[model samples]
Target: MCSLCGVLGGRGHWTDTSSHPEAFTHVEQPTRRRERQERTRLVNTVLDHYGLSLSDWAGSSYVLKTKTGQTALVENLTELWANAEQLTKHDFDPLDEALIDSLAAKAAR
Candidate 1:
């Protein structure tokens, strides 16, 4: 028997469906891709409203610059949005509050 057959007890590693119950199942990559795209789109929509945008730095992190000239290194969309909402709440701007509410509602969905 070949090396693969010997290791799999005479069954082909990729061709044998009897030994591995999940040999043909492919069900996670595309869902994750769509989720990532959607998250990025929603986050960008909110950021663009405030004249802010995410700049890719390295890995899964980004740099966000606020309209007030403040900068933050946000880990992800959720963290960045949350921080923005909190930081802007000190001044009590109605438009900002409404925008944050809209972002929160969309994120919850």
Candidate 2:
């Protein structure tokens, strides 16, 4: 599908739900937006290792881009990782020793 269609047809991912699923109503829009921002920040910490960055796209999707200008609009974290690998030509192994070590170091600091 084209980027525009994908964006227009976006659906909420399971991870995007709040602890109180019913809180997904319009009244909770602000809270949901904040959550997405936090998620983007945390994801960026991992993407940094691969020269990629992610930003919340209007609180609906993510904008993933490489240091060299390649980009992808992903609907969720699962798509984010797959597209990240494609853009960087590198595997994004969560269990990668270096990645775990890096995250550990960050937590320690």
Candidate 3:
């Protein structure tokens, strides 16, 4: 596996997914205390930066797809947040093509 998969796999070890199938805990950082809290924070940032919200997406659980959806959201939101750091950019805009493919798949509607 490559870096993305490696990261995903590591995150997998952090949570209990037996009941919820794709459940995961993000790589804990000083900034993030819990996985869902981090995701909630992520949702707010992405919504604010891109002027979009998870309310725009069709599914209830984007995390059902991957452990990195928050970051994927951030990456996706990059074009809208040109100068923000990896975290505070408030962009889930899928900047890299590979990241787009692995995460949100071009976001066409």
Candidate 4:
């Protein structure tokens, strides 16, 4: 599917909501946007280890890109690791001890 169509028709992933879907109505739009921004920032911390980065794309999807200009539009976190590995030719393990240590060190700063 085309990127535009995918963005328009995509279903919300479980991670997209801070609370129950029904309660999402009580959240303000800016608050939702900020949540997404925070998620992107946190994801970037991991992606940086692989020499890649992610950015929020139009508040609907994520743009994952490599240092040499390769890019992919990630629809959600479910697709993030796969695309990051493909783009960087490196495996990403969320539970890898080294990654956990790096994150812990960064958090300590």
lDDT per residue as tens, model 1, 35-82: 445655656776766677666555344567777777776555445666
Q: lDDT for every model?
A: 0.56, 0.79, 0.36, 0.79
State the lDDT at 14 in candidate 4.
76
lDDT of 3 by residue, 25-76 (tens): 5363323224445554555544443433332223212211122344433222
Order of all candidates by lDDT, from best down to worst? 4, 2, 1, 3
TM-score of each: 0.43, 0.79, 0.23, 0.79
Q: What lDDT score goes with residue 104 in model 4? A: 92
Worst 10 residues of 2 by lDDT: 1-10
Tens digits of lDDT, candidate 4, 44-95: 9988877889999998778999999999998788788877877777879878
Model 2 residue runs over 4 Å out of place are 1-11, 19-30
Model 4: number of backbone collisions: 0
Off-target runs (Cα >4 Å) in candidate 1 are 1-38, 90-109
Worst ten in a row by lDDT for model 1: 1-10
**Superposition-based RMSD of candidate 3 using all C-alpha atoms, in angstroms:** 14.3
Clashing pairs in 3: 73-92, 75-94, 76-92, 76-93, 76-94, 77-91, 77-92, 77-93
